[model samples]
Target: MSDTKDSDSDSGTGRCAGCMESTSEKFRGFLNFLWNPEEKTVLGRGGKSWGRILIFYLFYYAFLAALFAVSITIVLGTLDPNEPRFQTRLQAPGLSIQPKLDASIKRTSDVIFTAGQADTYTQYTNTLTEFLKPYKENQATLNNCTNGKVKINQQYSMEKPPPSCRFDLADLGPCRNEPYGYDVGRPCIFVKVNRIIKWYPVGFTDLSKAVGNADSNAPPLKDVLMARNRAYDPNRMYVSCYDVTSGNQTYLNTAAGVSANTMYYPEDNGIPFKYFPYYGAFLQKDYMTPLVAVQFNKVTRNVDVRVRCKAYALNIQDNERMRIGYFTFTLRVNE
Candidate 1:
């Protein structure tokens, strides 16, 4: 009888150890799924408490689902079915107003003694304004063309110059730097810019009227250097002009900066042009010159640009025949 009782006790002890091991492993897995366990999984004499806990979990999940559903419903209700509201959309703020255009146009007798003076501050404000009027309108039309549902891209008759150009140039060097534009393979450099400009307001209220026959001559910079004071020195520039991709011969931003001997090629990499998307106009013009920069920065879109071109007016006196001109007109968009 004693042996029988001892044997039965040993058998029950072995079974309890096995059951405990299995329970430990299963509970570990359950704990992994539940993250933190606050209540038990079963119910009865031992698990009536667990039953209450399970009910609590069910209520918690139901509450979370209801809150989520309510949030989604509210968001959907705010948007009109006819008016598409893209969750992911971006807009460029028309052309950023550079503050430089706010300056006065010197309005001299709008006549060119030599062809060099036609695009000067006293002359080209009227010329470029007329030339660029159509361009400004075209740009506006392109910007307004899209409404979240459709994506509109503006393809120019002229694409950004090749790997060496913002678009294709008739030639490899600065667009038409020669009297005859010839593009032989020359090493081309590229720089992209974005920034801010202060407008000083050119007085022509109607800048869009096409004025003179912009007979494509030498690039304005080339013309200025060769014509203004006739170069014996390495520092001066010839006026070189090219038609921008805006599909017009001129826009109001083109004007000549007066220099006694030579105009400076702008090298400003440290300053950022956050508000100016059209900042490349100067960069392209300056890149071909003897302008040297020790460092440069990059331009990104959608942020405000806060940079200034160190536009130095060359000191000139009439007795000195070496007056070179630099184009210094600013472009403004009225939103």
Candidate 2:
């Protein structure tokens, strides 16, 4: 009896052990990652690492894209500042530049009067008087120093300059017709005439000097800028362009549409230009050089700029006074 009871107890213990082993095996399947030595300690393939890699690639691609964008923007800016297309030519009247500049080469000596030369004195004096001899007594009104009649913006170029006096009188009247050749009217009529003649409301006084010059000996076709002057006021500033080169006067045919004797030349590279060639009459608004078939798109880029034109004096040059020369000035767009 004792032996049989012992055997039964042993069998019960074995069954209990088997049940515990089966339960451990099932739990091991659920927690299998806990004992994997290589996976637990290795340094890679985590979610954080993948996020960082993705972010690095995004920034790297963005930087390259920005660099390329800047490079393209710089290269694409080579378009002409002055559009030279024929259809768009008549858009801006001020931009309507002709082939060559036109203005009479006048000398200051032609207007100055000498005491001994009565004929010459009378001729200029008559011209002076004719300019001043207005039919009306309102001469002082036009002088800005006095009554200041016309507004500043109202001024424009006409075929003829504004009248010095009313009713185009032929003569200043001999007055004393005196041997001294002194001017008539009140005190300093000649001085006022001289002032008006020198005060050009339409022409440029100075020329520009540019930067990054391609050549040091050539005057390139550039957008002419206003040079410098002491008496120039920003609000009431006037402009004018003078011939820098002392070349012979060129007479262009506006009718036939070509220029001769002028220094401006077109590029032979057959590069299609965007600007039209324009020319005006010597002293008038006449189309001496009509909107020509030339171009100015590649003017500044191709041409080398070296020379900045100096202010040409149009009066006598004795005793350091430079006033006896012809400076036909016309203002072109600076900007």
Candidate 3:
């Protein structure tokens, strides 16, 4: 019985050794296939087959890259780098104001704050201070255009850039003071006409001839300036602001008496004609948009008043809905 058990154990050991040898041989063959196969084939693919696939992909990607390059070149060829291709909507420029409202405030266009509180109006004064920094720094070097001569139909180039007029900060008068009159219940708001490339303001020589009659709803330019008692200047682009909350009566004769409370720096309330026909930024690198500072003195306390400011010129349109050449904002002074 012991001899029979020994023979069976020997047979089992030999069968296990044979299975281990077969597995080792199969693993060696798989490694050889991955590194280098027989019959000049690499992983079952001949050299010519690999070469054909590589060449096909190279040509396909090369053609795709060439097509992309040509498409971009053609598109860019049709555009002017310095000027806009289409300016149909920008025929007339718009208006903007300084001392913009705080970003946290929900009402963007309205200026509302308590008169005596520093925290309430400090942001407004800071904005104006930063805005005038460049003008204050560069005023000495800028070209003098105080002769009131317009630069029109002139050629400009990169080598010979167009000259920009100097807008002296000193001309702002009392509004140029550090406090800007905000601490005393009065506020100064600066109005700027947006810059349009190669656009100039054309003033009316005669209001009766331009509008075809003096009885139009649009008040004559002279009447609009009558409140301020400014003499009419046909060569200048005039800016006028008045209370819109007054009923039926024209802006000059508003019930709230806006003209009585308003005063303009450089008293004329007009932008000189020389500032117009602004060439592009590249040609007129130092160009500064002229500003009209409107100071509101002794506004009725704690009342929400709507004001509309308009820039009058023969070329500039006055469409309230479109906000072309005009801007409206609310003013509320708290006690």
Candidate 4:
């Protein structure tokens, strides 16, 4: 009985080995379906089936790509390269004052000055230099703009527009001095008017008519023409810088410690007439907004004073709630 049981156990073990060998061969055959050129099968599908799937996916992606391209073409067709689609989006252009907020300050409109803090002031001065690089001065193109006026008559002309008026960095004068006046707690404020295409100054629309009449009663027109005549008229635009803490005055606020003095340099209170009717970047690649530097001669040290600079122009629209056509910033000097 024991010898019969031993023979039966050997036969059972042989059968199990045969079954394992058969399973291995089946797995190998299954793998061959993934890449079997001889059988014309790929990934368990015949050549015809695989070709159909490839064709289907190719057409599917091709249709998606074609739809995407058409959508982009239709969207781009609605836009005008020269004119802004939303003309009424902002009724008035904005005034940008710089030495913009330092990286540490999250608020975009405020400037903090610490007397004797070279790093803080250095960052601002460096930004000013970088911003003014395009307007540094180009003697070669100076002749293109005669007496600081570059005329642009039409839009989309194949020929390039006239060169922009030269706004040399030297025009900054004392504001360009070393340290930029922050060391002494008197920081320089640069003011630039936001560019609006085809928006002319509303206040001076009748400037030519006003210029023709020499009547003293027309003080507004006389002032406009006089401003146009002066090499650099300081009164073209009435700009006022005021200390917010002083008081809530009218539309214009005069800077504290500045009532008896003028803080504007080079006479032009702010943006000059030369940079008007902004031609798009393509027409004038080197065009830069004219910058006016306002120096605070009597800013109190270690005090926080809110400064607001307003540019009064007939064409410059103002918002009751927003600082439209003007800029407001906080000035704090620490000892």
Candidate 3's C-alpha runs over 4 A off are 1-54, 74-78, 102-107, 208-220, 248-258
CA deviation > 4 Å runs, candidate 4: 1-45, 74-79, 101-109, 116-120, 137-158, 204-235, 248-262, 320-323
> 1 or 4, which is superior by lDDT?
4
Better of 1 and 3 by TM-score: 3
- Root-mean-square deviation per candidate: 21.3, 27.6, 7.9, 8.7
Error of 4 at 42 (Å): 6.7
Please give, for residues 57-102, the per-residue lDDT of candidate 4 as tens digits. 9999999999999999998999977667887766777778877755
TM-score to native of every candidate shown = 0.22, 0.20, 0.77, 0.67
Deviation (Å) of 67 in candidate 4: 3.6
Query: Which candidate has the highest TM-score of all?
Result: 3
**In terms of TM-score, how similar is model 2 to the real structure?**
0.20
Ten residues in sequence with the least summed lDDT for candidate 2: 267-276
Which pairs, if any, clash in model 4?
A: 202-315, 234-267, 234-268, 241-255, 242-255
Instruction: Please give the range of 10 consecutive residues that has the lowest summed lDDT in model 4.
Output: 210-219
Per-residue lDDT for 1-335 in model 3, tens only? 99999999999999999999999989988777765645677776688988999999999999999999999999999986657788888888778887886677543767778888989888888888988888888789898776675778887788878788999777788898767988887888889999888788887877653331221234356665777777777778877766666533233233433354577876788899888778877777788889999888856667777766777888887655556877778877787
**Global lDDT scores for all candidate models:** 0.28, 0.28, 0.76, 0.62
lDDT of 2 by residue, 1-335 (tens): 99999999999999999999999998875565444455542234455766888999999999999999999888667643223224332221221111121233243321232224454345444444443334224433432222212223333244443323221111222221232123221111111111221122222233242211221122211221211212322122111222222221111111111122111111111101111122122222221111111111111111122211112122211121222111222211111
